[model samples]
Target: MLWPNATRVLSKMGLLARLAAHCDSNTHFLVRTSSGKVLMKIALGDFDVPAICVRRADLLAALLSALPSEQILLGHEFRHLEQSGERVRIHFADGTSKEHDAVIGADGIRSRVRQTLFGKSDPIYRGYLIWRGVARYEGNAIEPGANSESWGAGKRFGILAIGEGKFTWYATLNTLADHSDSPDGRKSEIQKEFAGWHAPISNLVDATPDEEILKHLAYDNIPLRRWGVGRVTLLGDAAHPCTPNLGQGGCMALEDALVLAKCIVNHNSIQAGLRRYGSLRYSRTRHIQQRSLLMGHIGQWKNPLVVGGRRVVTNLLPARIFEHNLRRVYSYELPGS
Candidate 1:
């Protein structure tokens, strides 16, 4: 995910240096080599976000510096939760309830508000799975850059530069349509999926011990009917559970938070503002969610004919067209009017 715009937002708001200390400027991206084989490669993705995390922590501390000691509490849990129009009432596990003007659920994909207000939907398991691991390198062992994904029939792999002498790589594969799994089943699945891949992928997978490998059952949430039901609002994976194919899951969450904050800051009535927030966030997120699923299906195609179909489309299209299509998503802004 490209994050220069977020850094600009921080810089404009005077949080640049705080963010720079912990975040790395390195990035890696997906690309095809001239030899026409899919492999781990690099481009730019981590250019300016993780470094900003330092500033974020500092700001949180600085904001908390003025608070009185009596106001701090820990080890609390919610025993009961209730939501009405424009506010959420949280009943403590202990018999206390507090009402807030608006509640934002930024928790995660299996968001309670999303399930409660919108109801839980079954996660659509695409006929695939993934393996991930991190590796350390020195002195540009694989070059300097981020944004790399090597696509192939029924599988693809990408090595993302996370800065600080490390990289994160994950590979996705098409399993049997009905293959359910177990704790150790993923190892066998990976060995089968990647056995035919190139040397770089094979090397990376082989270099890592089995214990370090992470398994993710590929899934996309069913599209919800609403985002914010009332005074309550949902953000991030709670709002739109995007497939990792596009790598915009985190980026979209960040955008949702910014837009929601901006909307509340600009509007007088919290309810109207949050409703508008839903309207504003819904279409964009839904489009991204659907497109990502579509993209994943395309990448995970198993048949030779479908594989050729994708290649034809990818070749017939200019790289600029892909860039242009993504630019609109990458370059979004809140409506100022």
Candidate 2:
């Protein structure tokens, strides 16, 4: 279910098999509250999603390595953008400029490319901090390929297997936005905050290498009513940034890449292609963005009574409802070949 078109495209390029060799094909996901009781359990493979997790660096490296050298330009920090008639001029920090028929702003949340078009679309913080890292699995109740997320009072923790015995772990804390500390300091804070949470929570945090831990403030941007103008277009976080609650940031970006390519290939000109791409993508991305925000809000509920109610509701909910929603999410397939 994950990477439907992406798998095909990589397979065509003879890279899917190579990538699959190292990726984590999770078959199920388990959800729990801080009380150590299972709240929800989902069988991912039942929905036909074979592969679930990919190491970010590995995927990016593989894609870049597959591309021809001449097609890539590295280390040129994007400075600004200028549009003159039919061409868009890209200015780099290294004092170089280039013009192209179209520009795709996949530059991320703090995108200079997006800033040129929509001035100061800074991401709004959602009053949470996320500490994430990959740690060696050390005898947790959860098995490999079985993703798990546990919710606590205004906090949450996740475990997803990447490959081998390594698990990608993330913990969220509800706090003032933009507050941060040194890596060592953040690591200490996380350990203290989740000290008494549950079994695997402490085990994972304690096992993580101090240097490998990362801390980031969770933030998301408002979706643009329109994604582009003229020959310039936006993709990924530049167009629709959402909180990580739904784990669809990378998935949505991959979808964007495919649709953008399809639109361009089907259109006669760059402008038409960009417009069509926006038309096809805007609504879906907006829906996901709003849904992700809502999910984050719900997941971060601080009141114990509310959290208990959530657990009750989750327990009482029919499995079919979960299946239907997941089916809708995984049902997205690229239009035509």
Candidate 3:
């Protein structure tokens, strides 16, 4: 999910038109109970730029298309790194090595670059698993340009329309870590978990082929005290991984790229640029990490009383408050913009 802020960044890069062609511009965000009771509705259209939903592959294709083909190295798996005085040498699993002035670890949550820089540490499991799938639904069961998340006891289901009669859905359930399903049983398990949820959810699951379903245990790292040292630094999930509660994992990474670029050009040396990037990003990403964790906890509430109270509180809260919060997130601008 690309929020307004991320889209704005892309727009500045001149890639919005290409990306928007494959995405659906989201206008409203709806929060509801498992049985389809609406608790809150947030108008995303109030923002200057609209939120967009696109398949990850589509987004990647759009981004890759904008870059030169030869510049991208395919099938290179990072194994470790060695940093000399002013250069960093990267080693890949294929026994290949390369040297560069600086290394940016945008690798991801299990970043090998991060481990080589900081000591190896496992990401914390947030006691939940998420299953994602893309399905084709021609029915008008779901409203166009609307994204909705339905909350149940210890489970949550989110549906995002990604244009062209395709919708992306994610289901989350509180569970022990490192859980696995039998061969080809992921779709069945998800269907069973969300069996009684509202309409279109089941429809989406049914439409998706078993092989297309993807499942993973949700994990995130505690905010790092430092993102990089010397000529090596981290970005996105490598620096701070957050739960998907806010749908900002990718969005934050987009923001980081822009800020990091600006910082590098504005600073005198590579090390200084990396330092400024980490310092500028630390507080904002930390706050988002903490906020997303809290939201996941609240959404996973299982007790009837607590869930009822949450719904009541959310419903009673003024729309302006929600709008203000959304604005704070979506209104972010690149430095000196």
**Most lDDT-accurate candidate:** 3
Lowest-lDDT window of 10 residues in candidate 1?
Answer: 47-56
The global C-alpha lDDT for each of the candidates, from Candidate 1 onward, is: 0.64, 0.79, 0.87
Per-residue error (Å), model 3, residue 117:
1.5
lDDT of 3 by residue, 16-74 (tens): 88888867778888888888878888887566666888778878987898899998999
List, residue by residue over 1-337, the lDDT tens digit for candidate 1: 3255445445544555654554455443445422344233322332333322222245456435646767765555444368776567966657777888767776577666566676667667887887787665554435555445667777877766555655667888777545555556555556666676544555566656777788776777866657876688788887788788877776677567667777888888887788888888788888889999998887777687887766666655556556556556645654541
| Counted clashes in each candidate structure | 22, 1, 0
Query: Candidate 2 lDDT, tens digit per residue, 154-233?
Result: 99998888777777889998999757674557668888888878777777887887778888888998888888888899
- Kindly provide the TM-score of model 1 when superposed on the true structure, using C-alpha atoms: 0.76
TM-score per candidate, chains pooled = 0.76, 0.93, 0.95
Query: Which residue pairs show collisions in model 2?
Result: 1-49
For candidate 1, what is the lDDT?
Answer: 0.64
Distance (Å) between predicted and true CA of 27, model 1? 7.5
How would the candidate models be sorted by TM-score, starting from the highest? 3, 2, 1
Worst 10 residues of 2 by lDDT: 1-10
RMSD of 1: 4.9
2 against 3, candidate with superior TM-score: 3
